[model samples]
Target: MTSQHEKNTGEFLGATHLEGCLFTGEWKPRTLTAPVMEPATGDQLALIALADPDQVAQSAQSASIIQKQWAATSPAARADILAKAVEVLAEQTSEVAQWLIREGGGAHMKANFEIAVTIKALRLAAALPEQAQGLVLPSVEGQTSFARRKPRGLIGIISPFNFPLYLAMRAVAPALALGNGVILKPDPRTAICGGHVIARIFELAGLPKGLLHVLPGGGEVGEALCSDPHIAMIQFTGSTGAGRAVGQLAGRHLKKVSLELGGKNPLIVLDDADIEAAAANAAWGAYLHQGQICMATGRILVHESIARAFTDRLAEKARAIKVGNPVSEEIFNGPLINQRQADHARSIVDETLSQGGILEAGGSGEGLFYQPTVLSGVRPGMRAFDEEVFGPVAVVTTFRTEDEAVTLANMTDYGLSASVFSKDIARAMRIGDCLHVGLLHINEQTVGDDVVNPFGGVGASGNGATIGGPANLDEFTEWQWVTQRDVPTAYPI
Candidate 1:
C-alpha cells in the first residue's frame, strides 16, 4: 500500500482534474483530460480532456463483443470479484473520502457516511449474485418450465456529484452482479474520488478488463454514453432536465433507461407530530451536504395550527448547524460542489424571497454556505415550492387539512421522496399511501433510504431504480423462455 502522501503526490492536492478509466472486460487505464474545480473555494482540482469519442465507441464495441463471454462466467465467479472489489474499497475508504471532500465539499462525517453506504452497497451486490434464483413450474403433461434471470448487455451508468460514491455503486453493482458489462460515467465535478476508487478497486480485485470502465467527462461524454448503440441500458442519477434529455437520447436508440432524477421532497408536520424530533430531522435532512442531495427534504409543510411553532423551532435548529470545511469533523454543512451550484442555490433563495416569502432564519454565509435558510409564506408558484432547491435552503408552508398536506406534498413535479411527521401511525400510513412518491417516511424526515427497498420516483422525478430492491433486480436481468420435450412426434400420418 502506498503512503497517503505518495498516492496523491503527482495529482493536484486541490487541483485534480477529470480522468477516465476504460476497462475492457479486464482492468486497464485510459485517459481523457478535462479541468474540474473545488466548490469550497475556487481552486483548480485538475484539467481533463474529453475521452476520444471514437475510443468511447470502441470501448462500447469491445464490451458488446465480450459481454456474452463475461456473462457466461459463473455467478459465483462474478460474486467473488464483487466481494474482492468491496475489500479493496474498504482499504481505500480514507483516501476516497479525502477526494470526495476536495471535489464535492461534503462535510467529513457526511463524506464518511457516504463511503460507508457505498461499502455496504458493494457487499450487498456481491452477495446478490449467489442468491439469484429461478422459480420452477409444476409439471404439466410430463413437462415443466422455470423462470430464470440473466444479465442484460452492456449497461451505461451515469451518476451525479452529490453522494458520488454511493449513487454510482447503487446503479453499477446490480448490473455487475447480474453479469452485465458496465461503462460508468461519474459526475464531472466529483469524478476523481469515485472514478479513481472504482478503477483501483476493480484493479485490485483483478476483474476482467472489459467488465467495468469508468469514463469521466462532462455532459458531452455522458450524452455520448447514453446514445451509444452498443450500450443496452442506461442507469442515470442527475437533475430532471438532464434525465429527460438522456431518456430521449436513449429512447431514440431503443435502449432501456433508469433515471433517478431531481427532488423537491417534502415533509408534512401534522399537528400530532413530535416538534423537537421533526425539527432536528428536518434540519439535518435539509442542510446536510449543504442540501445538495436530490432526496433532501427541501420543503416543510406543517399543519397551520402548529406551523408557527414548527417554523420557529426549525429555524433555530437550522441556524445552529455548524458550517466549515468538508474535512472538518465539527462541521455539519459545507460548500456546494462548485460556484455554479452555489449561484443557482442563491438564485432560488433570492427568487423565493422576492416572491412574497419571508426569510425565517439563516439566509447567507461565506463561500457556498447558505446558512441553512428557512423560508415561510412560500406559495405554489414560487420556485422554492415548485423547483428542487439543491442547497441549504428549506421552504415552510402551512396546510389546513390532511388532504391539503397530501396535495401540497404532491404539488411539485418531483415524486422522489416525502415524509409525514405524525405520531399517529394510522394517519401516517394513510397519508403515505396518498402521497405520490417513491419512498415515504413516518415520523421521520424524507431522507430515509433502504438498500433492500426500491428507491426511485414517478412523474418528473425520472424513472427506474437506483437502489435495486427485490423487484429492482429485474432491471439488470432479462427474461429467457425455454421449452423441452422428451417425446418426438411422427412427421406424417
Candidate 2:
C-alpha cells in the first residue's frame, strides 16, 4: 500500500505493508528502511526504503521498456493523460499542502503557491505533446526531409528536499509529456510527498503503469541513475557541490545531464526605492521557507546613501516575522528541515559575527527554529557575504556607485537569479542588464518564479539547461532527421 500522511498529526501510515518504491505498477515495500522525520518536532513520521544500486538498475530497466510503449501512442493520448493528472492533483490540493508543510517546513501561503505552480506545470506539460513540433526542411533533388523531436529514452531525475514537488515536476512532467520514461530519485528526506505522491497522482489520472518509478534513495541511488545504461539523461537539482559529483559521474557514463545547482543570488535596492516595499521583498526573498530555497536572496546591495535606512527597515521586518512549528502555528517562518541544517545556519551566523559582520537583528535560536536573521555592514571576505548560507539570514552590503552595485551583485560564482529594485524603471532595467543570472526581475524579489517561463541558470548555478514552456520540449528529447524519396538516387560512389 502507498504511504498516507495523517492531517494535523505527524504520522505516515501504510496498510500491512509500507511502500517506498513505486515500480512496474506496484508499490514495493523494501526490507531496509530509514525514518522520514518531521522537521518541526523531530518526530519520525514514517519509514522509507534506502534503495540499493541493483534495485535502481531494475527500476531503470522497467521504465525504459515501458517508456517505449508509452511513446508509441499518439500525442493526443499523452496530452489527455497529462490533463487528467492535473485535474486529479488539483482535486487533492489540501493533501499536498499538508505534506508540503509537514515534510518540508513551508508555511501555508508558500504551500498554496507551490500547489498552484505545480498544477500550472502539469497543464504546461499537457500542451507539450502537441508542441513537440517538427520542422520540414528543404531537401536536395526533390526529396522530402524533416527533423522531429523524439524522447530521450529513460530520464533520471533527482529532486531536492526544498520545494520537493515543484522541483521534481519541473523535470518529471516534461519528461513524461515528451514520451520519455522517468526514474525519479527524490531526496530520502521528502520521499513520500516528493516521490510516491507524484506516482499516486499520475496513477489516479490513468497514466499507464511502470512508465514512472518513484525510488527514494541516497547518494548510491543517484549514482546508479547517473551511471546506469538504461537512463539516457539525468536532470539533477541540488547544491553545487553535489551537482558537481553528479555531473562528473554522469559524464563518465556518456549520459546527457542537466544540473540545477546552488545560487548566491542578489537583490539590489536603490536609494529611490520605497523602504517599506523593498524591506518586504527582502524579507520574503531571504526568509521564505526559512531561506531554504536555492534562489534565496543571498545578499542585498543597497546604495550607500540609503544603506542605514534599508538595513534598519529590513531588520524590523526580520524580527517581525514569526517562526514556529508549521503544523501547529500560524507563522511565516518554520524549522530548518533538520537539526543539522539548523546547526549549520547557526554556525554561519556565529562565524559571520566573529568575522566582523554586525548583526542588526535575530542572532539567536532554539532547536530547529532560527529566527529570521539580518546582518548589516556585511561586505566581501565575510562568510555571510561569500557563502551560500541557505538560511533565513539576510546580508546587507553597501555600494558607492552603480558600477559597484553591479560588481557586488555579480561577485558570486553562482548565476541563478537576481533582482534590481528602483522606482525608476529605466534605471532598474539598466542595472538588471549588468547582472549575470538566469532569471532577473525589476522592482521584484529574487526568490519568486513562474514555471511557465524558461528556468535554469549559468555557470555554477546550472549547466545552461532549462525547464518550462517550449524549453522542456528540447530538454526532454533529442532530434531525428527523416528523409523520403519517390525514386532511388544514384549512390555518390
Candidate 3:
C-alpha cells in the first residue's frame, strides 16, 4: 500500500481559498494562512486560512444579502445549475474519491462509492423544486386557504468527517434546491474533500458569488455560524455533545436547526435468524468504514440460543477483513481518521476488558489501526456496550426473549437506526414496529441509505431530515399560508 506521501500518477487536487475566499460570479480565488493536514499521516495537505469567526459572520452576511436575489431567479434556472454541478461531480468522480480517501480515511472504493451516491442525491434534490407542492386546506367560513413553501433565506450547514461527500452534499443540494443560500462549516478534518469540491462546483456552475460559501474551520467557526442572525437555519451532523452545543447556539439566535447526532445502534438477531447471513450482515454493519458511522451497529443483541454461534462467525469474519492504508483497493478496513480516534476507540475497548468483558477476536494493531474487535459478556453498565464506539469494535450480548432484545435496543439515548435478522416475515414486521429507532431494517444490516427515505433520527438526534427525502426538502423551505375571501366586511361595535 502506498503511504500518504507517496505520489501517484493521478492528478493531485489541492485545497483552495480558505481566508480571502473564492468569488463565484467574479471568478477569483485568494490565499489564506489556514493549513489542512492528512489525518492518516498528519502530513500538511494544504495551507488553509484559520478563518476568524468574523469570516463566518461575513459569509452569513454576504449569503443573506444575496439570498433574496438568488431566490428570485427562476427555480428551473436553479435546477439547471444543480444539474450542471451533478454533471461535474460525475465527470470528476475519481478525483473526488482521492480527496475523500486522503481526508476521510476511507479506502478508494468506499470513497468512490460515496462520491457516486452524493451525485445521485444531488440529482434527486435538484429535481425536487419542480415537483415541490404545497397543501390546500378546506375552505373555512367561505374563505379559501392554501399554503406555499418559500425559501428560508440563508442556511448554515455543519458536516461531519465520517461522510465527507454524502452528509455535506445531502444538505447542500436540498438547501440550494429550495432556493436557500448556504454557508457550509464542515469538520476541519475532512473539510477539503467535500468543502473544497462543492465550493469549486458552485463557482463553476456560475452560482451567485457568496450564495454557497465554504467556511472550512472548527467548532468556534460553527458556533459563530449558528449564532449569526443572518442565518435562518442550521443543519449539523456531528457528535451528540457538539450537536447540543450547536442546538443551544441556534436556540439563542432563534434559528431553525437540524442535527444528526451520535448513535449506539443495535443489531438484534432472533433465535430463528439465519445464523450465517446474520453474521455476515453484522460484520458489514459493525466494521465498514471501521465502524466510524453514526448508524453503525455497535451493539449486538443475539438470541441466547444462537449467540455463541453468531459470535464465533462474526469473530472469524472480523479477523479475516484486510486492514491497511486507505488507498489500497484490496483493503477492507482502513486506519482510523487520526490517532485521537484510534486512542479513543482503544480506551473504550480497554475499559470494557478491564470491566470484565471478553475480547472475542481482533484487538489493536499497527498505527491508527484498531482491529475489528468483538466483546462478549458485556454488561449494561460497561461503557463499551452503552456508549458510541466510533471505531471497529462490536459488543455482543444475548437476550432471552424478543422483549429483552427490544428493551436493550431502546435503552440508549440515541434512536438513529436499528436492524433485525429473522426469517419470519410476521416476526420481522412486529420487531420493526416495536423498534424505537428512526430507521429500522429487516433481515438486513442498518447501514443502508436511500435518497428518497426521510433519513434522520428521533429523540436527541435533533429535528429535520436530509437527502431527497420528502421531509428533507420541506425543511429547507418556509411555509406561507394564503387566505382569500370574497365580500369581506368588518364592523366595530
Candidate 4:
C-alpha cells in the first residue's frame, strides 16, 4: 500500500490512480483504469486499471494450464495452504476492515462481521479437501464402478458490493481448496476488499501462480469471464437482472452457474410473540448494513393484535440507531453502497408514504446516508411492500391471521429467507413451513448467515443452488464415474 493509498487526503475523489489491473502471481498493469469511490463520502479511494478482454484471456489461459498442477497436489497440501490463508487474513483484520468501511461504505460492525465470516469460511474450506470422497456403485460380476469428484478447470466469481469480502471468499476459498483456478471480477466499486485483499491473502499463503487472478470491473469484464473458453463455471452474487444476464451468457457458453440473486425476504411477528424482542430483531434485520443485504428483512408482517405495539417499538429502535461516517465503530447505520442506492431507498419510502402508508420513524436523508426508515401500514400493493428495497428501510404490514401472513410473505416472486416469531415453537415452525424460503428461523431474524450452512434461495432470489457446506464440493467440482474390469470382456455378437 502506497502513501496515496493509505491517506484519506485529496480533493474528495481526486486524480489518484494506480496502474495495476490484473493480480496473478503479481500486479499486472493495463492502460484502462477505473476509479474506486467511497460510497459514504463519494471520495476516491484509488483509480486502478480495469482488465480488458485480451489481458483477462491471457491470464485465463495460463490459469487453466496451471490448474492441473494445483489439482495434482496432495489434499493435505491444499488444506494446509487454505489453513495458512486463514492466519494471513486474520492478521490483517483491522486493515481489511478499513478497506471495507472506507471504500465499500460498511460500518464498523458490518466490516468486522464480514471479515469474521470470511475467516470462518476459509477455515471451513480448508476442511473441504479431505471431506471430498468418491462413492462405489454396485457393478456386474467382473466390473467395478465408482464416482470421483474433479475440480472444474476454472471458476469466475462476480461478487456484489455489499459484503464483498465474505461473499467472494465464500466462493474463492472453496474453489481453490477443491483445486480449481479462479478469476474474480468484483464490482469495481469494491475492488480492494473483494479483489485485492483476497489476492494478498492467497499470495501470502503460497498459492501457485495463476491459480487465482483478480480482475475488477463492470459488465464487460463479467461477460468476458462468462464467455471465456477456460472458465468452466461462474459464481455470481448481485441483482436478479444482472444475474439473469450472467445466467444467460453462462448458459449460452454451456458453463455451470451459481446464481445468488436479490431477495425480498420477510420476517413475521405473531401476536403470541414477545413484542419488544421481535421488534428488536426486526430493527436489526432491516437496518444492519443499511439493509444492503440479500437476507435483510424486506417486509415485516405483524399480527393486527400487536401491530400497534410492534410498530411503536420498531420506530423507536430505528431512530435510536447511529448513522454517519463508517470510519468510527460507533456508527450503527452507515451509508448505502452509492447515491443510486440511497436514492432508491428514499424513493421506496416516499412512494409508500404517498400511497397511504405511514412513515413511523424516518423518511428523509441527504446524500448516501439515508435514515433508518420504518414504514408502517404498508400493504402488498405499495412499492415498499412489494419490491426489494436494498437499503435501511423497513416496511411493516399487519396481518389479520396466520394464513394472511403466510400469503403476504409468499406473495413475492423472490423467496430467499423468512422468519416466524411466536411463543410456541411448533406453531412458529408450522408458519415457517408455509412460507417459501431457503432459510428459516423461529426465534431469529432474517439477516444473519454463517459459513457452515448451505446458503442460497429459490425463485428470483436464486436458482436453488447453494454456496456453503457440502454444496461447495458440488459447486466447485464435477463428478465423473469410472468403470473397470480385471480383464477384457467377451465381444458382443
Off by over 4 Å in 4: 6-19
How many backbone clashes does every candidate have? 22, 0, 5, 1
Report the poorest 10 consecutive residues by lDDT, candidate 3: 9-18
Q: How close is candidate 4 to the true structure, as a TM-score?
A: 0.96
Over 4 Å off in model 2, which ranges?
1-24
Give model 2's TM-score versus the native structure.
0.96
Please give each candidate's TM-score. Answer: 0.93, 0.96, 0.93, 0.96
Candidate 4 local distance difference test against the native: 0.87
lDDT of 2 by residue, 36-140 (tens): 888898877667766789988888887788999999989999999999989988888887788789889889988999889999999989988887378999988
Candidate 2 residue pairs in backbone clash: none
lDDT of 4 at 206: 90
For candidate 2, give the lDDT.
0.86
- Model 3 Cα RMSD, Å? 3.0
Q: Residue 439 lDDT in model 4?
A: 85
* List of clashing residue pairs for candidate 4: 33-49
